[model samples]
Target: MSRRQRAASLAQGLLVGMTLGYTAYRAVTLAVNARRFPRLDRPHAPLRQRPRVSLLTPARDEAHNVPKLLQGLLSQGADEVILLDDNSSDGTGDLARDLCRGVPGARVISGAPLPDGWSGKNWACQQLSQAASGEVLIFVDADVEWHAGALDAVLAELERSGADLLSCWPRQDVGSAGERLITPYIDLYLLTLLPYPAMRLPLVATATAVGQVMVFRRSSYDAVGGHQLVQGDVLEDVLFAKRLKARGYRVLGALGGERIGVRMYQDYASSVNGYAKSWLPVHGNSRLLLSVALAGQFCVYTLPWMLDFPGARLLRVTGLLERSAVAWTAGRRRPADLAEGLLGPIGPLLQLPVYHKAIRRKVKWKGRVYEQ
Candidate 1:
């Protein structure tokens, strides 16, 4: 065989071998590191002393979804449910107050004007935190819905783990074909790459938090400067987790599939824009890192399917299976999304333009322009 043919054969072998090795590693890590919330139906002895729990939500132009979240929080028996309408042109503040009228311990606070150095959500959450009168603070997004006993389950997990902060991954409620093609990757990356158990280890910087639903002990929140430390950060959840980890606090992340759900975006356009706002900051606002990361994602997820060299089919099948397995482990149950995981690279590929926009400080979210 010619030198070129021999080189091609070696590369094919390497691809197949690497795929198999990585798949096995993911499977093992998932089994050991992935933590799932207890089912609501499962019986557990109630805590003798229920701590005061506050439910905090920040909203901007989320008038349509805030009512649902309010209803869910009201049902959860929180001591206080505080909503911040973040300087929305839409009547979000009025709608929130109307929804909570006559509901004991529920209040809506109009967010102060955006301060010079703070992101909108961060400012909103800081206001909520200050107004909170509970020992345990739970932050839920307006788009998220909680099942019966969700709060109890989260508190139970937090107590059991002895974590200073606990974050839960909600089940993705996909609406559009675009959502199916894109959203599953969030879980796939976490399952495959993040060392979930190491989040609690001292001196280890590995940390991740889902902002959709996070429960924090008031003490821990205060210790980390609450959201104040990450005031300007677009990805506040991640930075908060890192801050907690850096302070030698225990941070635990669990699957909330049985307890909480979120419809992250309505359609293709929203998904592109919504993800870009958070994704850009997660890469440290570095265009070079974003490019390298996207290229790596394509190689690991898309190249196998696109290539026709010997053993390519084996590598492709392995890639698809690996993604599907990780997605399932992360609480994605939709058959369509599982199938779409085969085309996982599409999500990252579509975000290339968004990354460029983000680097240029041109990304708009909730009608607010954020400068990088």
Candidate 2:
């Protein structure tokens, strides 16, 4: 064969090897972990002595969402529910007070002014923490809705696992085509990349958390300095989990599945704007690492489909199957969502511009600039 033919053969062989290896690894690990990982979506026997549970939610212009959350919390059997109104231009505080009126153990607190060197969400959560009187503190976002018996299930799991901090991954409720196309990547990375079992090991610092729903023991939160330690971080959830693990506090993750759900963004524009704010921070704000990660995902998921080399079809099919399995396991696999996942690298490819925008500090969220 000519030198050109030899190079082509080498490249084809390498692609085939990578495709096969990744497919096998993904399929087996996902299958094994599916059974091993703890799920909070199921029912559990009631706790003998319910810990004094305090539910905290921070709202910023969440007038439309607060009512649903308040209604849900009323049924969760929490000892108290504290809502922090974070200087929303809209009448979120008034709406909350009106809805919570005459409701026992539920109150809305006006959030203090944002202090320098602190993110809005973090500062709000810290204020809520200070006023919380529960033994178990559950921090939830305004957009999250809890199913019946969700709080009991979480408390049961926390007791059984003996974890100081527990973060539950809510079932994502995607509305628009943009949401379906983009959001599965979050679960994809969590399921495939994170070594879930190793997170408990002191040697491995592979800490991660979903911010939508997190339960922390008040003692542990106080010991770890709570949100105050990560006050300036945009990705406070992940950083707080890491800090807890570093301090020898046991931290665990659970799949909320149907027990808890969140509508992350309404439409394409909102999705783009929301993700742009944290894409760079998620990758630790390192431009080099972001480039490598994006390039690597593109090569693995999209390059084979573009090539006309031998075994290209097999490579593409394997890639699609692996991604489909990931989506299915993550509870995000609908026909449309899976079809978008099959299109390969479109999601990560679309994120390139968002990453650049984030790097340039041009991303704004909730009327605030997150300039570095």
Candidate 3:
């Protein structure tokens, strides 16, 4: 073979070998942390007594979600179920009120106008907190549905963990082909890299939180200023956890398991917009830094299948198992999730367009445009 051709083959060989090594390390760590990820389904001692729990929901144009969400919240036996109608054009308020009407301790509150500096949901959440009378507060998104015994399970965990904030990453549900393609990425993305144990430490960098369901002690919420502290942050849940850590408070994370589920996006189109709003900011919006991170992901995940070599094939098989294992912990076991594991390369490729829009800071949600 010519010298140039030999050099090219060597470079490709090195890249494949490196990818295999990284994937191998990831596989081992995933196995080690598999059962370690907290599950809420197990039995536990309930909270000492009724703590006057409040379920606060912030919604805008979520007519489709109100029925399921409110139904679950009402049945959960919260002290109060308060939903803030954040200037929705849809008749979400009417639906919520009708569902909550005659149900003591459950009511819909009309949200005030959006303030200049605050984001819509944050403003709505701040108002919800101000209106709440519970000693424990849970900020739930309109998209999440709580399963039976969910509130009891949550309260048990809160008391057991002794954490001021317990962030529950719900079971991500995928139905459509587009949903299948992208929804599982979140669970896979976080579990593989984030140090699950370090999260227990009061360290800001290792802090993370899933926004869909966050349980907070009212005392701790007021101590740190609550959503008002992170009104402008696009990644509000994660930032709020970091704020708690910086203040020397404990923050715990757990898997929702069978307790709760959320379908954050209905299809591929919505998924792109949903992810684009926060990913670039997660990388601090530096193109160079984001590019490096994406490149590393591509090399580790997407490039293996494009090559013809023994190491490449081995990496692909092991990577599939790894992805599937993480997906199982997420309560994701479907034809779609199986495809997600086998087609691991598609995850990073799908992220490209979303990252592009994220860097430009152009996003629209619920008929509102945000250039921030």
Candidate 4:
């Protein structure tokens, strides 16, 4: 072969080797994490002494979603349930009040006007923190759904581990085609890459948290200054977790394990827009870094299918194995595991629009705009 052709062959071979090595490493990590990651699925026996628990929900224009959450919270037996209505254009406050009428320890609070340098959720959570009077504070998003004994599982895990913060990663229930196309990547990104077991150590750099469901000892919340420290931060959950670890506190990540789930958005527009709001900020707001990462995602998940040369099929097969490992670790059913993993190539391509929207450094969410 000519020198140019020989050089091209060598380059392709090198790329294949790197892809294979990385894919193998990802598979092993996924398996290890699947076993090591703490989970909130076990059924808990009645505790000898239950702590005073305050359940907090922050709602803005979520009248359609809050009813189910509030109803679930009533059965969970928290000492207090506080839902903050953050200036909703919809009748969220009224609806919440109507639902909680005559219920003991359940009430709705109207959020004060949004002030400068405070993001909407952070301000709302700060207000909730001030109103709570429990030994433990549990934050639940308005749209989250939990199974029977979900709260029991959370409290049990926190007590057993003796951790200050227990951040439960909700299992996503995707009903739309767009959701199926995008949601698995989020799962794969966390379950496959991060060493969640190391969270026991004070590694602020590895700190990650899901705000959908978080349980914090009231003392730790006060110590970390609550949401006040991460005011105006779009990615408040992660930032809060980092601060907790930096201050000699403990943060543990646990899977929902069928006990908790959330359907973040309903359709394509909502899905894309929802994710765009924090994608750039999550990557440190560096377009160059994010752009390179997106390109790398393309190469890892999509290129093997695009390439028609020999041995590309093997790459595709191994990619499926890696993706399946992630889906399994995320607790997907067998059929879902096969289907989502097979559709892996489409996810990376579909994420481009989210990345593009985020790179602009401006994103709108719940009728408010924020700079990344």
lDDT (10s digit) by residue, model 1, range 106-225: 999888888988988889899999999999999999999888998888887778778888888787778788766666567766666666656656754577788988889999899777
Question: How far is 362's C-alpha from truth in model 4 (Å)?
Answer: 1.0
How far residue 145's Cα lies from its native spot in candidate 3, in Å, is 0.3
Model 2 over residues 252-303: C-alpha lDDT tens digits? Answer: 8888776787888776667666777777778888878777777766767777
Superior candidate under TM-score, 1 versus 4 = 4
- Model 3, 1-372: lDDT tens digits are 999999998998787777777787777666655767777777777578778899999999999999999989999988899999998888999999999999989999999988887878888999999999999999999999998989999998888888899998888877688877766778876777675787786678988898899999999999988898898777798899888889988998888888888989999888888888888767876777788878977776677778667577786677567667888767777756765777676667877887777778566766766765
Tens-digit lDDT string for candidate 4 (1-372): 999999999998887787777776777778788888877785656666789999999999999898888888888878999999999999999999999999999999999999999999999999999999999999999988877788888888888878888899887777777677776667787787677776777679877888898899999899878999899899998888888889888888888878887878887778888888888878887899889889777777789899866556876886667667676677676676557767767667788889989998578899999977
Displacement of the residue 5 alpha carbon in candidate 4, Å: 6.9
**How much is the lDDT of residue 297 in candidate 1?**
64
| Native-to-model Cα distance after best TM-score fit, residue 244 in candidate 1, in Å | 1.4
Q: Residue 150 of model 3: what lDDT? A: 91
Task: Output the lDDT of residue 6, model 4.
Answer: 100
Count of backbone collisions within predicted model 2 = 0
Candidate 3 — which residues are off by over 4 angstroms?
1-18
Q: lDDT (CA) for every model shown?
A: 0.78, 0.80, 0.83, 0.84
Q: lDDT, candidate 1, residue 75?
A: 95
Q: Is 1 or 3 the stronger prediction by TM-score?
A: 3
Q: List candidate 4 stretches off by more than 4 Å.
A: 1-14, 44-48, 308-311, 321-324, 334-338
Task: Quote model 4's TM-score.
Answer: 0.93
Worst 10 residues of 3 by lDDT: 27-36
Which wins on lDDT, candidate 1 or candidate 3? 3
